[model samples]
Target: MSEKSGHSEKKTSLFGNEYIQHYDKDGNKCGTSEEKTTLFGQTYTQHYSENGDKCGISEEKTSFLETKHYTQFYDKDGNKTGTSEPKESFLRGKYIQHFNEEHEKIGYSENKKSILGTKFRQHHGAHPRDESKKKIVQTSASNNDSGDGTSASNTSSSGKNFILWHVFAGLFLILTYFFWQQWLNKQAKEAEEKWKNEVKIIASKVPGKWLGHASNTVVTLYLTHLYGDRFSAKVNFRGSDQELQMDFGKGNYSTSLFLTSRLHAPLYFPITIPAYNKNGVVLIFRGKFANNGKRDVFCGQLIFDQNWKILGSFQDSDGSVGYWSVGECDGMPSNISGNWEGKWERGGLWNPLEVNQTRFKLSLKQEGKVFVGKVSYIGSRGSSSLRGEICGDYINFKYRYGDGVVREYVGQAAGDHISGTWSQNNSFGTWTVSRK
Candidate 1:
């Protein structure tokens, strides 16, 4: 009996000891097997062609003492063409050599096995096959005397078969990975779409905005399809605030939130704000739809950041809620408050400096929603008062040079550096600043 996996086939039979043979598409007998035991009770699988021609043989002996591997290869003429025997020690060192039809040493290789696969160096005259490929074929070859000594014409056949099999296997793995990734993306997209639809369905029943205030926080919930979700909400903690994102799937409901307490002003430019490290706040809300009720309502406990637990209720049709407010939670500060030193460049906006031509220094100070800083030309010492605000993870600042000459800077802040565009009136240029 035989089974097929991709382009390779494995055939099994009694053969006195239940050996198996492996082959490729071109009818090349790639490998054969047989079990044998010596006087010392050492048992291993032997490799040969059906006519008893030793194609290759490998035996792995592992016991309490040590583990050793013995491998040898022979051509169609029953002559020892190659031998890869371990040295005295059970180390990675191997004495590997190859011979031609005349039994003359034609090739020799140094093989070593490490964490990153096996490393081999074959020093040969003309024909050089990869030692790894030889090992792969030898490792799988079994003993089946029904087959011939692999027809010397097919000596190189095993290498070709190995290459083609790997090519097919590599392609198969790549395609499988690509399809798996696409499947994951599709599931994520479907989840996002479902959340949006649920928001809409619930929002339509409400038809208006609902506001709930508790303690020092104010909760404003909007039910509309305009802002993407059927239900959108904003939570203001004392002076810090940010929006919330909801995920409802598998009967479990939760919301991801961000703490914008350090931000003095709310950012509305990107509309959908990108999450920062400081903005990872999870709020798990659990509830179920009452099937027998007159109206749609959600009653659940609001678990805030795995800390504060509060009970809340919301009526979908009237846009009404009870005890729906999130209190203050400690969050990491922003990563953009420090002194930045780098170079600034000008485009068509100015002629004094070439594109990215001048070095500059900026001393930035963040106070709530404001960014106060000073910019000075490094070589020229010419300075200007810089004032801007943290717009999400970016800086929107402006400075005046001479005679009402204004240069506006918009840069994205990343760690110690700020890179963005500068526009003077209508002319545009680029600038970069690294933290001092």
Candidate 2:
């Protein structure tokens, strides 16, 4: 029979082959016999049979059983360059192997391990210490038990933490921006409100007045109407200084001036004639007027109101000789209501012979006097109007003639009489009226 089938074959070898072969549970020969061997000065022995089979074939020891331990060579930069099986002359303890460009072992570790240790410490010092490195090592061991690499966990955890940090930071930034914008809008609104209130407070301190004027040779007048109606005024030149007063029919007169009222019936005058009435007898006079020896006889009509006051007088000749009764009068009358007269002089020369009149008219409706009228003459030129008042004294009224000339009068009223200065253009003059 062949030696493989012999039961008592000689198994002696010069390598001292005391070993045991391992087998699977099915009794199949799974490994070779174990034997002890020595290489270099280290005493590690193989745990396998002479046929290259494992002796202790447990799962935990499979890697050691299948691989042979060999010395690896590295460059000074710690890059692996060569590998070799351990030999009899190999040094024990920690050592570094040196290799050439061809990956051949050219040198071995010497006392230079001190230098490499120093370099390793310096490298660690230069970089930030990873406090999680120990945990990473433990995790690596756990991964090795499950046959997976440890690098995947480190990569995944790092990426997850990085994304989480960015998301939180982005949300914080967005909220901050919105809050800042709202604060700015609030500030702007408050500022605008404050400015508007300040302007209003400043504007409240101004005075209220319509308009006024002043002049040397003129009396400026501003007239306002209470009742809205249009009236007319005419200035007639009756006669020069010391002229006879005679009856003149209609269509005969000298010079006549006419003025009109505004849309609201208020007359604004800038001038006035200066005079005042002394006697109170209201005279109704008709005369022929002359200017530079040119004469024109003018016929006129006179009337008074129920208060024994002259209302107004109208002249048909040259449209001159109208008079407004000054005092309190309500309506028209049939005759002159008061005997009123006045005289004026300029540059020490008597201006002309002129008749001025005033009268009071009783009001049938209200408790106070109503109308006031006045008239003045230079040659045949004169103006007249009837005025209304509330306080009876302190009269304010306006008059305008057909020639668009407006006059405003404001003055005081007394018993059965009124006196004030009328203004037109840049001239002013005193005037008075009385009851007949």
Candidate 3:
């Protein structure tokens, strides 16, 4: 989980004790340190030389309030070498002051906590009298390009500190990269979830019974099966006198998603239904959501010809310019008169639970809110008496069968459609009819 140690360093945890063996850059075993914590919560780290002789010790302690902590160091033979302690300044912020064995202030290091990680800028020098000498050394080191990497005046101890500083700097960069990658991955996942939710919302509007008229041509579009920008729909093309066929388009009639790029445009959508005519004319519905009195409707025109120029009307290959709009969906319809038809279902012989369909049709003649209709079973070729009254979008009536059984029909009329339940005492069935 961390990479603060050198490649040549080996860590050992024995009997819950923290033991570490240090190694030089050349892979030579240099020294070792063993840290032990007493029951009183005091930690002592014993340092050893390459020859397995005791060299120094580091003692760490914390105040009772835990607001302050200190670590003191000792040399071989138990002599104080230095101490690194923290100091706070309102103007300068918090920093660590380093001292030599003589207990004289040598230098200070500033510790900054950032979003990336903790960073340190440490400066070390001799007494004020040796300031001139320090400048001369720095000038010489910068000028001598042929000089060895190490400074001539610095002791072996300083050399060790120099290597350790670079090691920590490298580790800092690595830590930053690790954190950045984590942030990037999190953002990508969030964007993906957002895209999925947007698809669902837009898809919900797609699946519905949409009816629109363009001149004498009547279009009934059934959008269904929406998932991730893709959906299936059946386009029923009919004239003013033509009945809704449910299936009229030739070939695959499907189109790929251009939604991501077009979603932001003023044109909310453009669905291309292909292979409509002998010349392979593609009809694209370019539209937006419109309030159709009692409900939301998808009102737009079917752009013909070239795919790119979808902004306005175009001449279709069928010799006439095209336009269409959906005036009804999920809610009540304004008009209930037309050729309305659906299926009558009952339990089948093979499976008692499975419902089977029988074609039921109604030709309604509406005057104001009341309507008298002719109900016909397709195979029988015989018509029956049907009368229904419309209240808002609801229609209910009584159908007298040929055998004198009167079934009550209660249907909800929404957007040129009526569908409800029919019942006769213990017998019941569902009836749904769509306006042609």
Instruction: Name the candidate that leads on lDDT.
Output: 3
TM-score of candidate 3 versus the correct structure, residues matched by position: 0.27
> Whole-model lDDT, candidate 1?
0.43
Once fitted onto the true fold, the runs of candidate 2 whose alpha carbons sit more than 4 angstroms away are 1-369, 372-385
Per-residue accuracy of model 2 over 336-361 as CA lDDT, tens digit each: 23444443222111113433333222
CA lDDT of every candidate? 0.43, 0.30, 0.45
RMSD of 1: 20.5
Q: Can you write out model 3's per-residue Cα lDDT over 1-436, one digit (the tens) per residue?
A: 1122121122446566434454433445666655544433433555666677766655543559987555455554454566555576887665545556566776544433335542222223431112222111110111111022211111112222333466787789999999999999999899778656644654555467766643346667666744464555555543211111112133344332221111132223324454444222334332222122111112122322211111112122222333333443223335677798787554321123767677788988888767898888877968887876654454556667677766556555556666554444334345677776
Off by over 4 Å in 3: 1-158, 238-314, 327-436
Task: Give every collision pair in model 3.
Answer: 332-414, 332-415, 333-414, 333-415
